[model samples]
Target chain A: MSSIVSRNLKIYFRDKSAVFFSLLGILITVGLYFLFLGDTYTDGLADFNHPEIFMAGWIMSGLLSITSVTTTMGAFGTMVQDKEKKIYKDFYCSPIKRSVLTMGYIISSAVVGLIMTAVVLVITVVYLAANEAIVISAMLVVKMILLSALTSLSNTAMALFIVSLINSEKAFSAISGVMSALIGFLTGIYIPVGNLDEGVQMVVKCFPTSHSAVLFRQILMENSLNEGVKSYPAAAQAEALAEVKDVLGVVFKFGETECSAEMSLLILVGALVVFSSLSIFTLNRKKTA
Target chain B: MNKIVQVTSLKKSYKDVHAVKGLDFYVEEGKLFAFLGPNGAGKSTTIDMICTYLRPDSGKILLDGSEVGKNDDEIRRKIGIVFQDSVLDPILTVRENVTIRGSMYGLHGKELKEAVENACEVVGMTDFMKRPYGKLSGGQRRRVDIARALVNTPKILFLDEPTTGLDPQTRVNVWNTISDLQKQNNMTIFLTTHYMEEASDADYVVVIDDGKIAAKGTPAQLKEKYAGNYLYIVPKNKDSLLNTLKKNKITYKQNIDTISIPIVHTVDSLEILDKVRENIDSFEVIKGTMDDAFIGITGKEIRR
Candidate 1:
């Protein structure tokens, strides 16, 4: 099984074009933030203290969420390519069980997701530090690393279930293209969930990736949000943070109740379990021609 | 001889099409066995069932003594297959592909390294082991595929249309390697091919048509049963030869100046030669070929 996983990793990283395309979603988000969205958010919140740092936190959180989805999808493309080329037939002829091969694909994709997300996190942190936007904390750094790992695992399962249904490279490419185009909206990066229609907001909130984006926002934007609200009275500061969290999608609400960070974590875990089971069932019954 | 594989009344169907109908055959250990059929004649279906890639709808497939699906992992460990298409990773080097396949069978470290090198050597691909699989020519890629299959040191090796797309010379080279693997390693070889000449070299051949076994025997037995040698005579005087044949009531087919007589045995040709010597200018005896036997048993219609 490890052999299969290592083999997948070698082939995936060896293709330079695949690696670049996987990171393309994150690059696009960064470019859009710098060119347009960054100024728009800062100007709108000019009265708030340190609006630039707070908005940077928001965009970087979205970047982290999108990284897990895109890199893992790219990693699972290796399995789809193997099926297209009928290379999976060769593996099935060996002594390894079908379940083992399935796990190999999932684990390799998870590893890729983790690696790419971590790289994005490091780069984001460095850019903020170089600009002297916010003071860095060791605990925050540790929390971000843990959050990246969790998001990768959750998204790996989702990617596996999606990839299991695809049998050809052409179909896989089409799906990947669609995912790359819509992931920003799904994660509330292109249009914040709070700013969209009530119906559209519910759809975004229901998506597990949206919950991941919220969790990342809660952790990454905590310090910046506190600093931005310092000008208000002590009694109003607490209410002001709540208002800002609602406005920026740092937390989601079903109707009247706000979704706690704990609830969002539960959603991520639930997604991991449900999608992993479905993927396993689908792959075991996979029939190759 | 010990039997390595046995299939009894094995059947498989795809929806309304019966791909394999009550097929029964056994392969002896350490011998070359060939399965021959036209396109869509169920040769691949049968091979797939035997290789445990597909399940038979009915009947039993036993490898060594264990039934299929019951002990498939054990059976898989003892057999290796080189599919009709090259299944190795194109981006990976030949050595990497072989090593990964070997590791799947539980070999690791020094053992895996040795196995990869030895398998490459067996197919004369040692020098090209470091090259990417896609970079190799057709014949070289084929040899590397064979080497990958060999890495596990399986007791039986299955090759499905192994030389279907190679040049004639390359086909011969691949055949030579397959022959050496069987001879030197005492491994049972089960293969399917469209080329009758390649099947002719097998110890046993089975021909199937429309999901049923049409013929199964040794090459010599099939030749004798379905194909007969012919005596072709180019007579100096066609009129005289025709009169003599008419008077003697001899069975012959006339094509212009030449007469073809089916020879049941060598002595029949000698007797005909002596009788027709007076009118004949030249005569030749053409031995029956596997190509003739195949066409004679399977008929001439094209299958979709």
Candidate 2:
């Protein structure tokens, strides 16, 4: 299985175009936010001294989350291409277990997701600092590191579930395009959850990745949120923060139940368990020609 | 002879189509076995089941005395297959492809490297082992695939139409490789091909069609049993040819392209041609062959 994992990693890296194209998804997302969407978003959050950093933090976290997804989806392309070319026939008939093959895909995809996300994190931190935004503390930095690992893991699991149902590299590319585009809307990076209608906001809160994005906003935006409210009267500031928290998915709502940050973390964990099991179950039934 | 494989009452179906109805055959140790059939004749389906890639509807298959579906991993460890289509990773070098296949068989460290090297040496692919698989010619590509399969040191090597599309020279190259592997390593080979001439070298031949065995025997035995020497004549006027042969009481069979008269006497060959000379466009004394045996047994053309 380790051999299979290493083989997948080698194949993915050897195809320089595939690595570039996979990162292309997140790169395009960043370009769109900067060239067209960033100033529009910054202008709305004028109450803060560095609304640019506040918006950058929110968008950058969303970029990291979606980068894990598209990159991992690219990693699974090796598996899909093998199936397409009938290379799996040799592997399937060999003295190797199907579970081992599945593990190969999962492990390689997790590694790619984490590596690319780390690159995105570094650039983001440097960019925010250059703009004289609120600095990231060592404690928040530690939390981001842990969250980066978890986000990659969950995204790999989720990608595996989606990829197992697909059998062609062409179909994978088409679906990845749709998924990459939907990421911005779902994460509320394009439009704040506060600006959206109640119905649309509910949809955002329901997605597991949106919960991850909300976690980043709570921590990275913590200082900016506090700074925005310092000039308000005490009573008005408290009420406004409460409303902001609910609207921005800082606390997810299930009909009448408002979920805390710890509950959202539980959702990420649940997604990991559910998607991993689902992918494995589906892969066991997969028939190779 | 020791039986390397024993199959009984094997059957398989895909939805409404029954690909293999009932299959039963055994391969002997250190010999080449041929599964011969035309396209859509269930040749691949039977091979797939025998290699444990597909499950049979109901059957008992034993590889080296272990039940196939029951002892899958054990059987897999003992057998290796070269698929009809090349299955190597195009971007990967020959060494990487071979080593990965070796690792699946539990080879590691020095043992794995040695196996890959030995297999490449066996297939004469050592010079090109560093090249990417996609860059090799059709013949070289297949040799690399053979090396990858050989790295496992399997007891029985299954070649699924191993030389189907190569040029005559390259086809001979692959066959020579197989023959040498069998002689030196004493590896048992079970191959499937529709080419009758290719199966001539096989020790045992099983002809399958419409999900059943059409015929089975040694190539020589089949020729003796189903076909006999005959004189072939292509006549322009069928009625005149039939009348001439019938009036002379010559035993013959009428086919689409030619009329064939059994050659009971070697000296009578010229006389038979002489009798049909007036009505015939061409004539020849056709020696019986494995192809004729196949046509005789199946009552259908072997080649499409």
Candidate 3:
């Protein structure tokens, strides 16, 4: 595992264009956020108005979605390139377990996503600090990183699945673009779920991206556990949301909540396992085909 | 000698096209076996199956007596493959690529380092160890690829058109490296090449045409079997010589260039030699080559 990780890190660091594009993505997200909402903050933490919250949520959600799409694109694109060059054949023929290949790519892509997410976090924190809206906490930083990594894994898995079904880069690109757009729009990245009809909001909630956006927004907005819980009507909805918030808050240093962080951690970890298994199954199909 | 690899009735199809049609062959241990075939004759398909990259549609493969399908991981551990296409990671340095491949075989730390160094040395790539693989010349990259495969010290190595696009000089260099590795390690090698010269160096050669075995034997044996001894030629302009041979009732096959007679004894009779010299503008005898044998057996020239 360490060998695979080290090798992936080496490949990731070697490509200057990949690094530049990733940084550019983070910069654009941050720059857009500040351009729209930087001047809105007033006096301390009380300045959390609807538009300020909306912009903050938008920046977080948009950045996360872009990071997810870009990381998936880069990871699967590299895989396709490797396939074309027959590099995957060399690696596949080696004694390394297929699980190692899957994990190595996922972990490397997650790292990139984490890095991009960090850039956004730093930019947002700095802007917020400059505006004197709120003080940035180390706990929030940790939550953002963990959530970003999870989202990256999910995205990478989806990309791997897409790559398995097609053999051409043009087709992969077209599909990836369409899928990313749909995922982004459906997850309420461009338009807030609050602005959309309840039916549309219900449709959005069916996707993992919608859940990820909500989770990310909660983490970035510094929303309290009680405040988050009260927004849910049903007991189960409140319980699930409270549980997730507790896990996010505990990992990052947010206020205490009614649920254990272990449960939320399990959910994220479970999602990783499920998605990774799906990716591996897809990889097997490709190899056997 | 023990059979190192056995493939029985292997079949692979890509949709409607049958790539390999019920192919069967076995390679003995420590022998350099050459699979000679034209393009799309299932050479790569066979190699891919043996390396466990492509699963066969039917039949079975046994490597060193263990079923390949049942134990793909073990099979993979014992075999090293150099693909027809370049497989080197362009983003990695030469040394890094070797080390990573070695590590996959459970080598690491000093062992991995030493293996990488030795493989580089063997391929004459020591000087370019630090160079990124993408930056190297094509020949250099191929050498690195060879080193990467060798780093694991596999029991069997598969070379799929190893010198397909290389220049003459680089091809020779690559062959030399492979030869040295074979001699020093006593590794069983399965090589697929279109080049007759490459096939000539192998201990055994299997000529495949249209996904079936055209012939299989050592170079000398194949030449002897398909190419008859002593091709006698009568020049076109030597009408008297041809008439003399005809009057003598000498049996021969006539083509545009000359009339050929397959004979057991040498053309050393003075009377026959003098008649030929007196009437013929020119005449010559030449031994046949493997290329001729391939043409004789397959009834078609091996296309480039």
lDDT of 3 by residue, B195-304 (tens): 88888899999988887888999998888788655645556465666788888877677777677676534443344556566555555666668887888777878765
Candidate 1 per-residue lDDT, tens place, A1-289, comes to 8889999999889989998888778878888889998898788777679889888878988998889898899999999988888887788878987778878988899999988888988987886666555468998788788888888999999988999889899999889888887899888887667778888887899999888889888887887889889978888989888888887899898888989989999999999999999987887786543
User: Ranking by DockQ, best first?
Assistant: 1, 2, 3
Q: State which candidate, 2 or 3, has the greater TM-score.
A: 2
Clashing pairs in 1: none
Residues B12-102 of candidate 1 have per-residue lDDT tens digits of 9999999999999999999999998998899998988888888889999999887897999898888889899989988999989999999
- Who wins the lDDT comparison? 1
Residue-level lDDT for B291 in candidate 3: 83
Candidate 1: C-alpha lDDT: 0.87
Q: All candidates' lDDT scores?
A: 0.87, 0.84, 0.70
- Please compute DockQ, using alpha carbons, for every candidate against the native two-chain complex: 0.84, 0.74, 0.59
Model 2's C-alpha root-mean-square deviation from the true structure amounts to: 4.0
Interface C-alpha RMSD after superposing true interface residues, each candidate, one decimal: 0.7, 0.7, 1.4
- Looking at model 1 chain A, report the run of 10 residues with the lowest lDDT sum: A127-136
Candidate 2 stretches greater than 4 Å from native = A134-137, A167-170, A224-259, A284-289, B232-248, B252-260, B264-284
Q: Is candidate 2 or candidate 3 better by DockQ?
A: 2
